[model samples]
Target: MADPKPALVLHLATGGEPLLFALTTEESGKLAGKLTQLVKAGAVETVTTKDHQEVAINFAHVAAAYLDDLTRKTTVFGMR
Candidate 1:
C-alpha cells in the first residue's frame, strides 16, 4: 500500500464542520492563494466542494486553512 494523497481543508471562524476539498496539490495551492487575496481584500466568494455543492465563503471569517495529508508511515531503525 501507499500513502494517500493530500486534501485542502478550510475552517471558518464561526465554528462549524470543516470543509474538505479533494483537489490536487497544485489546485489546492491555487485555491489557498485565492482565499488569501480575498481575505486581504475583505471579500466573499463562492466555491464548489467535492460533492458539487456551492458554498459561499467569507474570507474575513476564515479562521485557518491548511493542506492535510492523512499520514505518512515511517520506519525506525530500518524496520517497518
Candidate 2:
C-alpha cells in the first residue's frame, strides 16, 4: 500500500501567492505553534481552521512571497 497523502489547505494573498499548510489529524496546537512562529516572522497572514479536514494560512504575511515554494513542498509530500 502507498503512504496516505496529507490533506492541505492553500492560503492565498490578494496577489495570488499561496501558502500551503498540512492538515493534522490531531489537535492543531502543534500546527498553530508553527503558524505563530511563521506569523511572527512574517511568513503567514493568518492561520485558522477551515473545516474538520482543513486549515487555512494566508500568504500576506509570507516573507518569501512565493507560491512556487509551497507548490514544490506540497508536491514532494504527495499532496495535490
Candidate 3:
C-alpha cells in the first residue's frame, strides 16, 4: 500500500516563503503543541529551508513563531 501520511506545510517568516514536507498526522499534532516549547527549550539549533537555505534559530527568532491555518479556496469573484 502507498503511504497515507499527509503533507504539513511550514510557512517561514522569511518573506512568507513556504516549505513543504511530509509528516505523520501524529507528528503534526505533536509539532503544533511543542512548537513554542521547542523554541524556548533551546533544542533546535538550525532550520533548513526547501530552497537549500539554512537559518539559525535563536531565542529572538523562535519568539516570533506561531501556528497558523491557511486555506486555498476559490470564490465566485476570485481567490481570497
Candidate 4:
C-alpha cells in the first residue's frame, strides 16, 4: 500500500513562510489540539518532524494549522 499520510501545514503570523510537517491525520489533529493549548499558555515548543528534524515554534506566531490533503496514489492489489 502506498503512504496516505497528509502533511500538517502551519502558517506563521508573518504571512509569508509556512512550515510543513509530514504526519498522519490523527497525529495532526492531536498536534493541533496541543498547539492550541500551548498558544493559550504562551509557550514555545519544539516538534520533531518525520525526518527527525527538530523545529522550535512559538505558538503565538502560529496563524493557522491544518492538514494538507496531498494527492494519494491508488494501490491495486493482485496486479503486477
* Predicted model with the maximum TM-score: 4
Q: In model 4, what is the error at residue 33, expressed in angstroms?
A: 3.6
Sort the predicted structures by lDDT, highest score first: 4, 1, 3, 2
lDDT tens digits by residue: candidate 4, 1-80: 65566776777877987777886566666676676677666578777666767778777877776555445554232232
Positional deviation of 74 in candidate 4, in angstroms? 16
- lDDT at 24, model 4: 55
In model 3, which runs have C-alpha deviations exceeding 4 angstroms? Answer: 1-6, 39-80
Clashing pairs in 3: none
Model-by-model lDDT, in order?
Answer: 0.63, 0.40, 0.46, 0.66
Show where candidate 2 strays beyond 4 Å. 1-14, 17-22, 43-80
* TM-score of each predicted structure versus truth: 0.52, 0.27, 0.37, 0.61
Output the lDDT of residue 19, model 2.
46
**Worst 10-residue lDDT window, candidate 3:** 71-80
Candidate 1: misplaced stretches above 4 Å? 1-6, 14-30, 70-80
User: Candidate 4: minimum summed lDDT over ten consecutive residues — where?
Assistant: 71-80
Model 3 lDDT tens row, 1-80: 54444433444445465444444455456567666775567455444433445555453333244433233332232123
RMSD of each: 6.7, 10.8, 7.6, 8.2
The better-scoring model by TM-score among 2 and 4 is 4
As a TM-score, model 4 comes out at: 0.61
Model 4, CA-based lDDT: 0.66
